[model samples]
Target: MQALTSSFVSRSLVPTTPRRHRVRPLSVAPMTVCIDQSRKEKVVVIMGSTGTGKSRLSVDLATRFSAEIINSDKMQFYKGLEITTNQITIPEKCGVPHHLLGELPVDGPELTASEFRSLASGSISDMTSRGKLPIIAGGSNSYIHALLVEHFDPETNPFSKPLIPIELRYDLKYMS
Candidate 1:
């Protein structure tokens, strides 16, 4: 349970499974052509209030878009705080490649915002370069917001538009 999106469906709700050993690399085909670094890659950042199914939506979308999941939950990154953290179980992930989940030890020093930015940005760039969609998700709305939208002024974004209509925001209604 985490941030829930209006479009979230329950069945594909993915959680992580604990791994006793190392995680193997996914069997994905290499890209034959190079992607231009100048172009921004598509990013899916799932954000909402806590216990709203954000993680579930992320896994569902990741599977739908063949995207990789990256954890932005600050608490879930630690090694020994599993119970307190409410991390996704590995089996629940359904074999999708998840990054930065339980990445550090419980006693490890807290990760600074700058450090997280570096790690998340690096992972996104790497994933995009390989032609996979990068899904950034977690219950930490502030952290996720900082990583995705803080640096840019939305008003100045030329491409920013009302992808989701204002009417849809209410009851998520649509016409046939």
Candidate 2:
């Protein structure tokens, strides 16, 4: 039997016009979240386990709402490991801007939840300031929790100390 060559395969399978990947709405009923799109400060976060299509959903939402995507996946922060970490590709973004996705160096130090919160908050504020919606997507629950639950105001708490003797910190393991 004759083996098919690269030329034969390309000729047989490749379409004459390059086809773009189509984004389809999920068949399942949509979950409700309280988001006032009219409010510029409000952000949409897509959280789920790995391989649950958080990136896909974020891309779709970003495109629909003229928003930008901010990746919250810790593993996807560092450069490389695209396939292993399932980092979103440029084509998949469909001209939507993404922040904090594959932006860190491979050898960079490990990011703490606080750091992630800071980065994500900055991205959110920047997008909101410009009247663009901010869509955060990732599987990192701890990071998402930090971004959402923990409110840090330097102006309000100038000393940056706990209000009481007991620290008001997030215990993720206990919560999880």
Candidate 3:
């Protein structure tokens, strides 16, 4: 498996420039369109069924892109299901940093959708701040959807907070 993984990854390590795309927002009323092209950071998400090499692919991409991996497997969060969950081995990571892998105790409560989103978002923010690409890999569709699409209401989600826009972060005179 290691040999196969290494061979596949080595073949795909060529660096390439990022691509730009024009995005049009659908609106019912006429309004000025704003496109934020200044943001350069990109996130890679890999999702698939179990035993489909998702973890392997994520590690490979992380190596090629100088990225950190975030585990999104709902079962992989528990501490005692390493074998059962087929968690990625430390050696398999190939020196790439990984987050949220086997973090919670086995007896602890399962991670809620909002909690997963919050934790994953935090990891993404930290990685982006350090100029590292974030690679999210998992088999959990719900967790992925929650992180990417669901808006958190402050009344229900303690982690809900306004995020500083990239433009504003750069524009603030006191930031640097």
Residue 142 error, candidate 2, Å: 0.5
Cα error, residue 145 of model 2, in Å, equals 0.8
lDDT of 2: 0.63
* RMSD, one per candidate, in order: 11.8, 13.9, 12.7
In model 2, which range of ten residues has the least summed lDDT?
A: 25-34
Task: Point to the candidate with the largest lDDT.
Answer: 3
Supply the TM-score for candidate 3.
0.65
Q: Residue-wise lDDT of candidate 2 within 30-132, one digit each (tens)?
A: 1222224443255666666665566766776666666898888889998887888978888988999999888888897988778887887778777777888
Candidate 2 lDDT at 44 equals 61
TM-score per prediction, in order, is 0.64, 0.64, 0.65
* CA displacement after TM-score superposition, residue 1 of candidate 3 (Å): 27
Rank order (by lDDT, best first): 3, 2, 1
- Candidate 1 lDDT over 29-114, as tens digits, reads 11111124345456666655555555666777677666898888888888877678777788778788888888887777887655
